[model samples]
Target chain A: MTSLVLAALLYATPAPQANVFTLETHWRAEDGSDRAFSTLKGRPFVLAFIYTSCPGTCPLTTAKLKRLDAALKAQKTPLPMVVVSLDPEHDTPQAVHHYRERYALEHAEHWSVFVGAEAALRTLTQLLDFKYAQNPESKQIMHDNTVYLISRGGEVLTALSSLDDSSAPLLEQAAQSEGKQR
Target chain B: MVRLAALAIGVLLSSATRAEGVLLPEGRFAPLFGLDKGQRSFAVAAFRLDRRLVTEAAFAAFLRSKPEWSSASVKPALADERYLSQEGGAAYAQAPQTRVSWFAAQAYCEWRGGRLPTTLEWEYAAAADEKVRDASTDAAFVKRILTWYGKPFRREDLLGSGSLANVYGVEQLHGLVWEWTLDFNGTFMTSDNRQDGDRVNALTCGNGATGSARREDYAAFMRYALRSSLSARSTLANLGFRCAYPATEERSP
Candidate 1:
């Protein structure tokens, strides 16, 4: 149908290539650069999904990521990070920066914060195997507190639940990748 | 003069639409599956669904166009080793191509000028029996569906894409393969489903019902459970998919 053709064209924007790089999906980083996901490569990165206003799991997820961040620092390993916002409406660039400051992770290695159009968010989340839903009534987003470890080659190494004490393996993998890159 | 011009435009549009599939009109659908709020009704926008389950031949044709999606070319991260493992070449070409990941299904649909239907849209359309809508409560109908549910999918089954037409003229939605919804992972659940006391209560009826929420709907409940268990890269021997698109000029406003 002509409508189907039109829909396909609409979806044929910049990305959704069904690959790990997802490099074509563009976003506005907290620092205000028009960046693509491919630019986030060349270092072992941790991709964590959170929204600033989440009262439940989002905070816990960050705390867990921060712990991992601290451990990586202690081990002299640089963990490049990108904490994506599930609620770009509330967690704007300014809010993400505030979060960075609040966590005292401002000086941490490459923990770039981002807020962008829902389309880029969806593409990234889908590639990361993340599932999230926003509840308008409760004003809370329902999702898993998931953290993904990305290898230097852009493969998603593993997806770990943030509530667990199982950062040991992820830490070791990231450290090894860090050594190879240097 | 305006009326005549509008009619002329409509004539041209109908002719254009006739080039492919038919449109299922807009309606209010209480999905028997998916992120359902208890007794909550949701809108099903007007859309067009491909009349058939994507067949192996169709997929093979798709692969010819998208070399990167070929079984040998796709990396393990994007797809598993079992992708097209049993491809019998032209012999089994018409069989419904199973053992495909969600990404592959999406790409196939995109190539076909549509997309994989959302769980809500799939459920909304499937609730109909031949000649009646919302046959969910119809005992005979539900029993027939359950029969297919209990029946195991034989790998040898061929997808003709012309049988078992529902009221909307959609085919092979059931008694065929478990089709993939575009956002299959959106159905959420707690790992500790057996948790006792307040924890269980909060997880279940917290916002509304989730994971085995509609226990009475044994079939639909199982579907949700299966969907939640699968990751985006999961491929199955019995799972395939169909495509859909928003209806032309769908003025939801």
Candidate 2:
């Protein structure tokens, strides 16, 4: 399955000797930057995918991300955030920039939004094994709404859904797991 | 398309037959099982599930109408990359979508010119079978049939969707996702002193037809428990639903 390859790319780094990181696969950032997953070399990243036009779950998802962020900040363990635009053609950098600002996600360098071509998006999506579909008539997309937790070295720690309320706990667990290793 | 057109015309012609106007039987409560707290007096439709679940194609059409609400709209729940295809992504749409919160379902139904089914109506319809005369007694057989159909029976022909519709011609009630109804507060096991007027009506009809709910009178008992366990903010993969409307004279355009 494409998910296996994508999972390998996400969980396995560019080099065997390299420290592990997650969600840093070949996917692009909002500025159209495409580098190896190693781009996020030293920061713990919380990744979520979304489109700007959605009014249903996306806003709630962002709110949950913010809640997680706030929870980490309250504990003084704030990490970087990454919001990937699933609707690349429509959700541009400007739109992402606006969304981030609207959601008050502008202060952290560890935070950035990504958009890319359909092929690249598909490749990253396949690597991550995230499920989504574009409708034929309305051209709307249906997808899973889970956020993936990636380590500083680009290794996928785990995924959390709003239903599970696993965002903050998953990140804390990842940090704790990484701390024990160090 | 012709068959669909004929079905549409048939639905138009039989509007009066589906009216939920009958009064409740004695010793029962109103049909609005879950949302009895507020002033929202929801109506119930006495129908059965169509053998086939609603398909991904049918739901995609719904998504198309409400383009603003994509899976991507919510960034952190599940991976939301598939945007407009019918491959692996179709499974989530194909399975009864559970993770859908009550708010989202209501919005979807509103967009489609219908509303979510009432808890009383959903339980009544789901628990009823063709041979089971009493609504109270039909629960066991309905549960058995649903369990049987839901097992590893993988025949594509078993979907029996548009063809083998239920008594009221509504499709895919039982085996789809546990449907969202207008009643969120109604749980399957909660004890309430309130009387359901709709169940009383169903019992009266069963009596008139010489068939009665045989197993037990725990009709309202089961619905209350299920409704209480549901959280308003949760969505799941196995949770999907069909919309309902009062069988009134006003038609959907």
Candidate 3:
């Protein structure tokens, strides 16, 4: 109860929103090809980080993205999803290809899996204020289970930890915001 | 009267420690051959699993002894290699195997001269303390414990130790891997001739919401539907299992 009260107080304090998304970051393709996000040329993008081997939270996270994709498609929305792998060492182009196939992610024009060197990925995650700590002794990483929503113009729109059907309203709000900016 | 009731509740909440291997009368149920008049007509057997979870070393020996059994496929994402290590070599094996399918777990028990305990038996063991399911205990007690001023002894990083064992020596029946039981398809509400491990989606059905469950776990007829939705090959980072055997002596508590 005390923690909840403290959290509410902290939330009330107005903190300036930081520019967490950088378009210059290089991203990899499901085919093992590398390219800069700037090359995508200002197309609105939704991004999430995941490893295929995770079953607990990762699967649920992927399902959320899938749900979001379906919602956008139903509305004929143009935003695409960019999935970056945290386990870059294992998630090869071929592995990502397999994952895409398994998840029926044939929506290639709307989705892409990116893999890069460990340091590059780590730097980007840190810049975004993503918290992931590897317990060296246990070889396990404890990370905040958050999904980042990024706009094409390199702005972090929102951070979502729980993705349910109720998020459709938030999606609509974001879409409206994007329309106003255009 | 209120004070008396409060004292009774307090005493009920924290008074008993489970005796090792002494099967409490209601501690377990025997598997039945079939049902009669809505009650399982078959004689319930006494199944008291080992006091400790089968260690990695023991499972490793089983795998080595029977090369025919398929081992966990090695992947870069998989951190633990020793699925059943006794000495705790690496944390991967120490954490417990999550992706193992129900069939594969059953195979391990058969190889080890035992069988997996039925779901009823497993729950009985977990409920060894009569108040185990009573959720009315004060959360303030937990908060009070955390505010202590003196040095406290704490066990760290050990999975399923003997301290958590039940009266019949069954450890970690809850909050661990959702064990695959022999009676997989039995209804939780009333006894029926249902398939074991049958999967059904019942989220839309008006059965009251369960205490937080996996979203995908929502299925079947009013929470009585069995889980067959999970892929047999898929393993999760949180899943681990234990095996059980029939007691040598047919002594009823």
Sorting all predicted structures by lDDT, with the top scorer first, yields 1, 2, 3
List candidate 3 segments past 4 Å from native: A1-16, A135-140, B1-253
Q: What's the lDDT for all of these models? A: 0.68, 0.49, 0.47
**Which fraction of the native contacts appears in each prediction?**
0.15, 0.00, 0.00
DockQ of each: 0.16, 0.02, 0.01
Q: What total of clashing residue pairs does each candidate reach?
A: 0, 60, 20
Which lDDT tens digits does candidate 2 get at residues B1-253? Answer: 9989966755663343223222222122233222322323333333322233334544555565565555656322222232222234644444433445554565555554555655655655544344432344455654544353345423232233421234434445544334566544423222231243111222232231222223243433333333444443334344456555544425433
Return whichever of 1 and 3 wins on DockQ: 1
Ranked candidates, highest TM-score first: 1, 3, 2
Instruction: Compare candidates 2 and 3 on DockQ and give the better one.
Output: 2
Candidate 2 at B137: error in angstroms?
41
Weakest 10 consecutive residues, lDDT, candidate 2 chain B?
A: B197-206
Please provide TM-scores computed only on chain A for all of the candidate models, following their numbering. Answer: 0.82, 0.75, 0.78
Please report, as a residue range, the 10-residue window in candidate 1 chain A with the lowest summed lDDT.
A1-10
Q: Candidate 3 residues A93-154, lDDT tens each?
A: 77887787878886657787888754446445644544343322222343445566666555
- Cα lDDT over the full model 2: 0.49
